[model samples]
Target: MSGSWRAGLLAEGVSITVTAKAYRLLRAILMTATEDDKMLSRNPCWIKGADNERTPERPILTLAQVFELADRMADRRFKAMILLTTFASLRWGEVIALRRKDLDLTARTVRVREQLLELEGGEMRLCPPKSRAGKRTISIPSAIIPALADHLKRFVDEAEDSFVFLGKRGAFLRGGNFRREAKWAEALKEMGLTGLHFHDLRHTGNTLAAQSGASLADLKARMGHDSDRAALIYQHATRDADQKIADALSARVKAERKKARKKDH
Candidate 1:
């Protein structure tokens, strides 16, 4: 039955993602029937890797590229948004949900208490983060503190409950509206960064943090990921970073040898 289902989906030319989701749904139903309902002697949906969705590689922008992208924003308000998103590894939902009180410029931290979720009918709702770890306070990089402060002064209202990022007409910003108003696609084209998603900003930030010799625990805390596996995926060591580690190890070994020789003498 699993083989037939796979064959039928392939014949229909369904996307890999859709196929994987469909297969998982089918497997889940069959598993329930076999175990809970006792309708089947054994489950037939035993396809390996059929339920796994292979995510495409997201582009990791360099620090220079990140700055360049921010500079190209036509709306001055969005400049700080881009910078904060990259440096702080904030998801779109979390960043948009930021309130004036959530940020502490003096302390250089952004407290993520909730996220703004856009519902099916385009209604915006504030809900708790996807995971407990998501409700965290991230330490902001000092380099972007000035930019964040500037954004608050210029765009955000003085009220603590006021949204940190608002639309030009002082309305709540939605994901679809943000893309249209920000001219996100055009900006990417101008920077020669075609096919880059907004989420890639978070990915870039995570990659940068990992490259900074962040321990697994540190990465998990900063990224607000619930699982070690998710944090491990972000630990992409660059060639330069790897070289620095090798050089440091070599120096330590050489110093130890020199000390040993001096003691013998």
Candidate 2:
């Protein structure tokens, strides 16, 4: 049955990723039913590498490129939004959900408490973050503070509970609406980053943090990842730091050899 389904999907030109997910889901359901019926001692849906799907590497922008992209954005609110996501490693939902009360300019911290989830039919719901780690307090860079302050002064409502970022109509900022009305695509095009997604800003920030010698725990906390696997991606991204480690080891060896030679003499 699995083989026939796979063949059918292939013939239908379904993507491997979609086929893999469908098979995985089907396997789980069948296995669970079989277990309940005492038809099998264990799940027999094991397909090698089925669960280890890999997507293409996400594009990451440098700090300069991030600022360039932000500057190119016509909306000043978006400029602050871009900077916060890149520097604070915030997700799109988290950034859009920010309220005046969440930010503390005096302490330069942003408290991530909840997210504004945009459901179908333009309905918005406020919910807790994606994970426990998602509800964290992140320190903003001093450079970002000025822009955030300016944004608050000009764009945000004076009330603490009011949303920090809103559409021109003062409605919740939906991803689709922002992409269309804010000219996000055009900004990317002007920056020569046509295919880059907004989430890549978080990726860039996490990679930069890892390269700056942040520990695994720190990376996990900053990226709001519940698992080590995601944090390890940033560790892998810091190949230049690996080179620096090699150079330091070589320098230590050279220093030890020189000391030994001098003592022998």
lDDT (C-alpha) at residue 32 in model 1: 97
Lowest-scoring 10 consecutive residues by lDDT in candidate 1?
7-16
Tens-place lDDT digits, model 1, residues 12-105 = 3244578889899988999999999999999898988888789556688989999988988878889999999999998888999999999999
Candidate 2 residue lDDT tens string, 68-134? 9888887777888888988999887888899999999999998899988867566899999989988
Off by over 4 Å in 1: 1-52, 236-265
TM-scores, each model vs. reference: 0.73, 0.73
In terms of lDDT, model 1 sits at 0.85
Candidate 2 Cα lDDT to native: 0.81
Deviation in Å, model 1, residue 111 alpha carbon: 0.4
Q: After superposition on all CA atoms, how large is the RMSD of candidate 1?
A: 8.9
In model 1, how many backbone clashes occur? 0
lDDT of each: 0.85, 0.81
